[model samples]
Target: MARKVGIYTRISRDDEGESLGVARQREDCERLADLRNWQAVKVYEDNDVSAFKRNVRREEFELMLTDLRAGLIDGIVAYDLDRLARKPQDLERLIEIYDDRPRLEFATVTNDVNLGTADGRTMARVMVAFANKSSHDTSRRLKRKHLELAQQGKASGGPAPYGWQKGDPEKVDQEAARHIKEAQKELLAGVRIGTIRTRWQEQGLGNPREGTKRMAHHRVTHILTNPRLVGYRTYHGEILYGEDGSPVMGDWETINTVEEWEAVCAVVAERQKSQPGRSLARTYLLSGIARCGLCKSKIRGQTNHKWQPGSKGARYKYQCSKVNGGCGKVARVGEPVDELIAQLALEEQRDRAASADVSPERRWPREQELNDLNTDIAQLIEAEKNKSISVSTLLQVLPEKERQRDELKLDRARFYKEQKQAEAKDDAVDLSLEEFFDLPIERQREIVLHSLSAVFIHPSGRGKRVFDPDLIEPVWRE
Candidate 1:
């Protein structure tokens, strides 16, 4: 009786999006099965996947093994032994399976294999070892070549970044670059990065790396945070620094300054420390902004769990509780107070234009100091590299300088965010007042943070259930 055979085929890449190469392999394997007088039961193919790379999943290969173990196929046919596996562990599994069934047969279109015999298994193992060696050597060479290209600030041949023209690192796409800058500004101004991502998707602002397929939340953050936007070469998410301890600037026309990049990175890092998706669960309009009038602690918004389905009571309220280090003295209903606070903030914006209290020329006074600190640090590293300073001295000085630089970077980031918020508040007032309620909670809170400094909720008398707007005191910013 003819043995039932399963044909296996694989190709590392299907550039044309069609499995034509694997299809040819399948034909050849089926022909081999016919020559051996075996009935071809099924064909398993893994396309655009590497056999050598252990990380790459060979789904069809695994399924064929399952069928082999089930005795559904008494024979296996492939184009070559190497196509079966370049990894030794994979070969051992097949050999073990073959040992379980003495009648099982394995053959290839390119080579005759009798896996029931020890000699055939040894030969197959030797061939796969050589194949594994070849893949390792190729991987090493490619990694070296990639490092060399990155050192020279050249693309290592992939999809272009979102802000740059495709396949051209030196040229900047002005419109795309503008969007990146806007993303940075929006992120620092307290707009959620997810919101920016959705906006970009709606606007069709995609690139080969970003918008072409999908713009996930992490990918959107990557575009905003990558140092490449400021004309620096990066590899595997790390900026490559030169021997002088400075970043290797790329050939691209820069979209943002170093200061802006530093600031945005600081903001991203700070946000990462808190629950990143907390904004999505935000229930109250003025949770963190509302304070306890007695103890001066931020009030949190909470749902009144005491009210069941049929109960008539406040569903949510802002409370200053002792558990969170508040005096446990103030509580008020959520919706009416939220509406009044927002209204008061809007009135503050309409009554007076935003004032810097100083001219634009006087802003950012510490920029020069920041530059000088960087210059001094770079000079020290260069001095140490030239043997002008000893390693001991270099290490001693660099830590403190680095600390100061990091602290200054943080201070600058905060100042920039504050200034941007003030500017955003001006823009907020420019919008129709009716639109404020339509914004996301985070945006509304951000606008209120700039327009009004604080909302002091004075305690309502005990048993006073009526909603009172007079008890809420809003301190508008000067």
Candidate 2:
């Protein structure tokens, strides 16, 4: 009786409507079964699958193994041993299945094998070992090529980043590019990343990878912190440096100036270290800004969780956070002390509103100039690419243009600050003292820190839990 054989075929990458390679492999295996007078039971195929990828699921491959163990097929016929599996461990599994059935047969388009014989099993093992070695060699070569391309300042194969299109990093998307620049300025100006992220998501700003809206906060931070924005290449999270210790310039177009990128990174690192758990939570308005008048130590927010009659589950307060014995200074009620600070901030704003206009007009001309500067830089890079100008000309003129742009950015930031101050002055007059606390905690913190340089609470002797107005001194900003 003829043995039942299963024909298996696979292709690593099968482009749409282009799977002739795997089709041909299947045809060859079926023809071999016909010549040997064996019944071709079924065909199992794993399209667009790599045998070398251990984690990638090959459903048909698994099904074939299942059928083989059920005695549904006497053997598997493929174009080659490598097509069966490129990993030695995977091949060992097939060998083990064949060993369980002494009558099982295995064949390739080029060779026939008997699992019942020792020589056939030994040759099968040797073939799999060679296939595994070939897989490793191919991986090593690809990695070496990737590093070489990176050294040459080219984008190694992946989806292009925001503000850029695949294989053309020189031409940037203006709308997306503007967002990147804005994020850098915001981070440097003390706007929290979560705030920026929320605003961007609300404004319908998003990258290609994350869609047209609702991006994660870390994605926003990633764009701001990327070394690639400054025209440098990074390998495994470390910037690739030249022998002189300067960053190696990449072939891709630059976004922020190198100085601006470094400054953003420094600010982010500093904030991360200073703010402990729940850094971005913004639960306390004055946690990092207030100080203990007695010990001159930072007053941090504390929560007491003891449940008493008519008491809330968690009671919040501001206490002296001295490591070596606190001066026993604490604000028993957070609401009253917070209210007092809010009232003081509003009073200062009312006074400032009397003198300064604080309503600086938006510098549209400066913004236009910034847009023009980007055009000029792009033109310079294009000229260099076309061999119309030397790279020396690019390296020279680009920095000056970048410097001008950075200066204009600083001016724009100042205008924004003045604008916010003017708006706060209006809010102070319109909203009641209680309504001011109802604002987002971030906005409340911004207004308080903007108006006051320091808020110090002194101890008012023993058994005095009451917040004495005379003991609290706020140093208003000049």
Best by TM-score: 1
- Looking at candidate 1, the ten consecutive residues that score lowest on lDDT are 206-215
**Winner by lDDT:** 1
lDDT of 2: 0.74
Residue-level lDDT of model 2, residues 1-478, one tens digit each, is 8999899999887644367888999989988889889999899988778999668988899999999999989888899888888887787788789778877877888766555678987887888888888889988998898778767767676556776753466666677778987766656545688887877777766552322445776788888888888888877677785533346788877777654666677667667878844556568777867778777777777777664658754367778854535665554456667888889888777777777666654443577886787678778777888899999977988889879877876665555444534443345545578787766676677778768988887776788455678877888888
List runs of model 1 lying over 4 Å from the truth: 1-60, 71-80, 102-116, 165-179, 192-217, 274-280, 288-339, 354-426, 453-478
Per-residue alpha-carbon lDDT of model 1 for 1-478, expressed as tens digits?
8999899999886644468999999989888888889999999988878998767889999999999999999979999988999899999999999999988988988887778999998988889899999989998998899888888887777556778776575788888988998777767667788788778887877552322555778888888888887788987779997765567877768878766776677778778887666654356788877899899999999998897876777789999999999999889888788778777777676666564343472256787787888888999999998999999999999999889987876788777656654554466666555687777666778778767788899988878478777889988777
Model 1 RMSD, rounded to 1 decimal: 5.6
Deviation from native of the Cα of residue 103 in model 2, angstroms: 11
The 10-residue segment with the lowest total lDDT in model 2: 416-425
Clashing pairs in 2: 153-251
Report the Cα lDDT for residue 195, model 2. Answer: 80
Supply the TM-score for candidate 2. Answer: 0.49
